[model samples]
Target: MRLTFLGTGSAMPTGTRAQSGYLLRHGDETLLVDCGSGVLNALARTDVGYEGVDTVVLTHHHLDHVSDLAVLLKARWLAGETDLTVVGPPGTSDLVEETLAVHEYMQGRLDLTLRDRTTGTFDLAGFTIESMAVRHSMQCFAYRLQPADGGPSVVLSGDTEAFPELIEFADGAAVLVHDCSFPDDVDVSNHPTPTTLGEALAAAEAELGRVYLTHLYPHTEGRHEEMLASLADHYDGQVTFAEDGLTVRVED
Candidate 1:
């Protein structure tokens, strides 16, 4: 399986990174997770473009995470694509409905389906997937996926503060894309600072493979080394900041 970071920035744009989006490709299956503000063009830059993707998995309803879902749909519709499946948490149906309501022209144009996963394991494309609730201002989930054909497990932590449950959920995975939204000096709450995230990882002692820090805010500018050092102070693991267009092969 291969993972591509399409957008790694937070609500605030830095031009260098888009919002929250990722592209996952395994065998012939493709899944887009959390299409944010600039992700449409970001997707366009990928080899697959928007046409090759037929499914999107959203982690939460925040604007920075979901802003470009409609744009993707519109782009696909314009290209004569007729079907799309958008899978998300409990409020997905309402989210799609309300979104279409706002853009009345898009209603009934495509065979758009919404799947809601509140808990438990489910199949997505060709992957066996599980999800867990994370610490966030709203109801959010971190997804764990293993390809049905056999591959290393990959975990995508949406937007959450560092906690045992999130770490435990990602335990043993080959890769974890977690939110490290700011440096230790930011004094954040919902999102994790380097110290908080490192503390959480250290406390759990889970073998979380190579963890990638994402969901960066502009405040993280020019301070990547210091932030990484801060996280290393508590959790001694291979951690690095994720950037847009960064592709990583998920393998042990």
Candidate 2:
């Protein structure tokens, strides 16, 4: 499986980064996680497209994570396609309904399957998607995606602070895409700081294979290298700073 980072910026966007969007592809099936601003444009830079994306998994209702959802839905309808499935937290169905309600003209133009997921695993195409409740302001969730064919798994910790449950979500995964919203010394609430992430990684040092930090704020712009060095002390695995358009292949 290959995972591509479409947007690595935080709630606020920078000149180089967009927001929080990632694309996971295995064979013909493609899944998108989070559709922030500029996500569709970012996908244009790659071989993926609205038509090729079969499922969209959302972490929360934060605008930075879901602002462009309506636009994506509209574009798919205009392109004469209709099969799309969305899996997210409790408010996912309501959010989609409200988004479509505002664009009432586009309602019913496409067939959409919305699943309001909280916890546990579900089958999506050929993958087993597991969600865990995360510590965030709003109702948020982190996802663990494992291919049914038995390959390396990936965990995406969407917009969350460092919580004990994260280790469970990332257990035995090949990659952990975590939210590192602030620098090491910059303290914040409901978001992971480098220091907090460091502590978390220290506890799960053996279980993780690779750690990639994303959802960076402008505060972390010039300190990417420093963050990696500090995190390396806690996590023995490869530590990478996620950038827009960055792609990594998962191996078992």
Number of the top lDDT candidate: 1
Evaluate all candidate structures by whole-model CA lDDT and list the values in order: 0.91, 0.85
Per residue, candidate 2 scores C-alpha lDDT tens digits across 1-252 of 999999999778788999889999888778899999988888878887876786899999999999878888887777777778888999899999888888778877878899888799888867888888888999998999988777999999998888665876698999999999888788689998766888787775347777888999999988988887776676667778898999999975
Total clashes, candidate 2?
0
Candidate 1 accuracy as lDDT: 0.91
Model 1, residue 170: distance off in Å is: 1.1
With a 3 Å backbone cut-off (N, CA, C), the pairs that clash in candidate 1 are: none
How well is each residue in 37-124 modelled by candidate 1, as lDDT tens digits?
9999999999999998999988999999999998898999999887899999899878987988898788789898899889778888
Best by TM-score: 1
Query: With candidate 2 superimposed using the best TM-score fit, by how many Å does residue 18's alpha carbon deviate from the native?
Result: 1.3
